[model samples]
Target: MNAIDQNAIQTLFTEARTHNVWLDRDVSEQTLRELYHLMHFGPTSMNCQPLRVLFLKSQEAKERLKPALLPGNQEKTMQAPVVAVLGYDTEFYEHLPRMFSHNKEAKSLFEGKPDFINATAFRNSSIQGGYFILAARALGLSAGPMSGFNNAAVDEAFFPDGKVKSNFLCNLGYGDASALFPRQDRFAFDEVCDVL
Candidate 1:
């Protein structure tokens, strides 16, 4: 394949700041599906694909989420076109026979171990969340991911059965650039990376 254009890369990464302000436009359901279709291809450990997203679009659902937010995150969570409740299924391993080994044998790896199940769920689901952000960007949407909410409360409100648990929240929409603060600085490569 030919190299990706520099401008496209810049648009998806460098110039793509974390959006805090959003416009009044609505995000269509089809668009959301398209975003998921693109993101689902990103690999995870053993193809566990543990992420479970709850898209809050209606006013009632958004209101239900309010009590779970920290004081600082309330406004952003309420104003965005959609607030995705990113979560992980603690019982994800139950499906491993289909998702991982493609045979009945894979269930043995995590059959009775709660600790192993939790570890795999959190690790793979976090990776899935990363893919979600990238997929949103690829679909011309902006994101503001935050962890300020009460995860327990969110889980109670959204996933009452306890099979799934919240990880982080992301606001999604067409960003209101006029409300953006000046972009912040970042650490240089030497400050964050090392050569082998």
Candidate 2:
């Protein structure tokens, strides 16, 4: 397979910023669907595909989410066009027959273990969240992903069924570049990586 172009790489990675200021633009339902279609393709352990998103687009919906946010995250999140509550389902194994069809026993591995279920769901959903941001950028939207909220409040407010758990919150919209803080330094490769 051919590698993607440099500009595409920049769009998805190098130049992407965590936006805190948004333009007064709307994120369409079609675009939100496309975002999910893109990010769901990211790999998960045993093809569990545990991530479930709740996108708050209406003022009423955002208001319901307001109490969960930490003070610092409240303003920017409410101002953004969309706020996605990224979560994972503990009963994700129930779908294994469809998602990992080749393995008839796939569901058995996680069905009865609470700790294991939590670990797998959390780990894989976090990976999907990374893909979520990249997918948003690939589609010309700015992303601001943060975890400063009260998870219990969010889960109770949104996923009251008690099966899904919140992982993080991400705001999506056209961003105000002028409001961005100066780019921060990243650790050099040798400072953080090691050869086997």
Candidate 3:
């Protein structure tokens, strides 16, 4: 198979920015659904897809989420067309039988182990959350992913049942280019990687 072109690389990586400000355009529900359809293919441990997303699209939903954001993040989150609450389901193993068909007893492996259960949920969910951001970018949307928020407050407000816990928040929309800072430097390969 052929490799992706430079434009795809630039769009997904080199030119993408973590947008803090958004334009006035709205994000359609159909676009959100498409984003999920693509990102669902991303890999996860045990195929335990624990990541659940709540899109705060209405004023009322954003109001509920506002109290959970850190002061710096509040304004941008309020302005974005959509804010995604990425969550991890503590009881994700219950569906492993359906998700991990190759391993029939996968659910039983995690049922009684609290620590293992939590670890798997958090680990896989974080991976899925990252996948979601890349999926958004791939779909021609800019995203601002932030962790500066009260997870407990978000969980209480959105997922009060105690089954799904908040992981992170990602604001999605057409980004306002004027609000972006100059691209920051990243570590070189040799600085952060090791050849084993």
Candidate 4:
């Protein structure tokens, strides 16, 4: 397979920064729809696609979310053009029959198995969340993914039905580079990975 262009790599990873501050700009609904369209293509185990997003765009919506946020995350999350409440559908297996076309019995395999379900939901939602961040970057938006919040409180506020569980919060907007601190270090391949 051919490598992607350098500019694409830069946008998605090398030059991408986890932004905490944003420009006073708005993210249009069209751009957000496009982001989801791109991110949905990311692969998930058994095509489970557990990750769900609640985009808090209005001031009222952001207000509702504030009580769940950690003090450090409050201001930036409120200021962001969009704050996405990323979640995992607890009953994701219900969609498996439709998603896993090759195996109609896939739903049955996961049914009545809370342990398997929880693990799959958590693991795949994390993968999907990563894809969501990259997709936002690809579409010329910045993201600040954070977890310094009360999960249960967030779930109560945003996902009261209990069908979905909040996984993390991501602030999305056009970033202001002037506010960024110096970039941090990353582990080398030898330090973090093993070449098999």
Q: Show the lowest summed lDDT stretch of 10 residues, model 3.
A: 103-112
Please give the lDDT score at residue 28 for candidate 3.
99
Candidate 3 ranges beyond 4 A from true positions: none
CA displacement after TM-score superposition, residue 109 of candidate 4 (Å): 0.8
**Which candidate leads in lDDT?**
2
Ranking by lDDT: 2, 4, 3, 1
Tens-place lDDT digits, model 2, residues 1-196 = 9999999999998988999999999999999999999998899999999999999999999999999999999999999999999999999999999999999999998878999999999999999999999999999999999999999999999999999999999999999999999999999999999999
- Name the top TM-score candidate: 2
* Pairs of residues clashing in candidate 2: none
Question: Each model's TM-score?
Answer: 0.95, 0.99, 0.98, 0.98
* lDDT at 5, model 4: 100
Error of 3 at 37 (Å): 0.4
RMSD of each: 1.3, 0.6, 0.8, 0.8
Which portions of model 1 show Cα errors greater than 4 Å? Answer: 102-104
The residue pairs that clash in candidate 4, if any, are none
Query: What lDDT does the true structure give each of the candidates?
Result: 0.90, 0.96, 0.95, 0.95
Error of 4 at 181 (Å): 0.9
lDDT-better candidate, 1 vs 4: 4
